[model samples]
Target: MSKETMPAAEAQSYELAFHVLPTVAEGEVAEVFQTLKDLITKAGGELGVEEAPARFELAYEIVKHLEGRNRKFSSAYFGWVRFTVDPAKVEHLDEEIGGNKSILRHLIIKLTKVEEENPYFFHQAMAEQGKSETIDLDEEEAEATTATDEDASESETDSEVTEDKE
Candidate 1:
């Protein structure tokens, strides 16, 4: 097929989630994030929604082979980026990310249409959920206090009636 007659490959949406090694200094974390974005751009990716890296404890220890030795980590800076790129370019991006020493682990997933249209902000939702839980706890404590007061008054009334009858 002639180049002019060939149909252009459709760009597909993808999300890249990564955990940066804790060894990376706090000040340099942003630099690492920028470098990742640059790599995607170089691969002809159009960047979309993204969350900046934030330090968080991992669910379990992660071991990575670095500098000819195995290193274990309990926490890391985590973040994700959404982008659209030709399917053929994804492999190249994956290989580049795999070679980066600063990244402890990374994953790239092709996004469904629903996911691409509505990006979820996990951290923000977690914060909001925490606030709502706190409010619920306070309300439960208040209800308990009111119930205790009602029980105390009922017990006092019963004792007075028994004394009067005697």
Candidate 2:
């Protein structure tokens, strides 16, 4: 088909999940994130929901080859951004992100309609889970303490009975 006759490509929803190298100094992390967002905008992508990068321990060590040497990291700052762009432009976006040294790894996936509408905030969910776990531990510890106190009293009662018999 001739270029003039072809319809313009429709923009599709996509999400970019990326892990920033842990070596990136805390202060510069924001700059790196902004750069990534800028890349999306520059590529004719419209930005949508995004989560700021937050430090997290990786499930396993990740090795990245940089400057002719392999570097291993056990932790990194992870975040994700959602956007919409023509499918044809995704390849360029992928190349730009891959060439970035600050990013340890990244994945860009076409998002389903449901995923685009309801976003999950990983960090917030983790924080809430941690709080609930702490509360459960506290309750268990209190129960253990109460049980020990009762056992101690029973032991004292048994000694009193022996003394009376003597």
Report each candidate's C-alpha RMSD, comma-separated, in the order given: 13.5, 12.9
Reference-based lDDT, each prediction: 0.82, 0.83
Tens-digit lDDT track for model 1 on 1-166?
A: 1012124578888899999999999999999999999999999999999999888878779998888999899999999999988777888899899888899999998888998889988667766897777443445566533434434544666555443442
State in Å the error of residue 153, model 1.
Answer: 44
Error of 1 at 8 (Å): 6.7
Off by over 4 Å in 1: 1-8, 134-166
lDDT of 2 by residue, 31-105 (tens): 999999999999999999889899998877899898899989999999999998887788879989989989999
Using TM-score as the measure, which candidate wins?
2
Tell me the TM-score of model 1.
Answer: 0.74
Weakest lDDT window of 10 consecutive positions for candidate 2? 1-10
> lDDT (0-100) at residue 103 of candidate 1?
96
| TM-scores of the models, in the order given | 0.74, 0.75
| Model 2 spans with C-alpha error above 4 angstroms | 1-8, 134-166
